[model samples]
Target: MTGGEVAGLIAAIAFLILAVGIAIFVLRVAAVTKEVKQTVSEVNKTLDVVNSEMGGLTHEVEGLLVKANTLLNDVNGKVATIDPVFTAVGELGESVSALNNSTRNLVTRVSGGVVNTTKATVVARAGQKAYAMFKKNKTEQPTK
Candidate 1:
């Protein structure tokens, strides 16, 4: 064969090798892309499930919040109802303390008056006895 024909044949063989390499690279890229697509699809499904679960969780939390608010309101109402009872009890305690103090003062005054009256009676009786004794002695003796 001539030199030109030999060179052309070498060029054709090189081009065939390049084409084979490009085909192999394209096949590898295609396989990777398919795997990436499957992974993305699975991730999308998982995200959908998580989103649905979050929706239910949000609803449950809202219900819990409402119940908590109701419970707080009930507790507030009960506290409001009991506040007056506690106030009344405190007032009653004060009134009882005042009554006890007044009773103590009255007892002290009555006892003091009784003691004074008894002392006065004893002194009057002693004076009368001494006067009678003096009169008896004067009569028994000569006129003085």
Candidate 2:
């Protein structure tokens, strides 16, 4: 063979080797890009699920707050209702105290009056009996 033909054959073999290396590099880059795209998609899906869970949790918290407010209002209303009852009980206690004082005074007056009248009658009867006894003793001793 001629020297020029031999040089041309060596150059063609080197070009083929370079082309194969470039093709392998491109294929490896494509595979890495595909993996990156899949990872991003999975991240987006996870974010969507997290957002939905957060929304549910927010709704539950709102419901619990409403229930707490309602319970507090009910307790306040019951306390308001009992306020009047407590005042009425206090008034009833005062009335009972007044009635007891009046009853005690009335009973004391009645019993004191009855006792005075009985003492006066007993004193008067005792004086009359003593006078009759003195007259009888004088009559029995006068014959001498």
TM-scores of all models? 0.52, 0.41
TM-score of 2: 0.41
lDDT digits (tens) for residues 7-89 of candidate 2: 99999999999999999999999999999999999999999999999999999999999999899778767855765555555
Global lDDT scores for all candidate models: 0.71, 0.70
Model 2 lDDT, full chain set: 0.70
Displacement of the residue 14 alpha carbon in candidate 2, Å: 1.4
Considering every candidate listed, which one attains the maximal TM-score?
A: 1
For candidate 1, write residues 36-136 as lDDT tens digits: 99999999999999999999999999999999989977876785586555555545545554555566568678785422234334444444444455445
The candidate scoring highest on lDDT is 1
Clashes of each: 0, 0
After the best TM-score superposition of candidate 2, give how far the Cα of residue 70 lies from its true spot, in angstroms.
8.9
Model 1 Cα shift for residue 28 (angstroms):
0.7
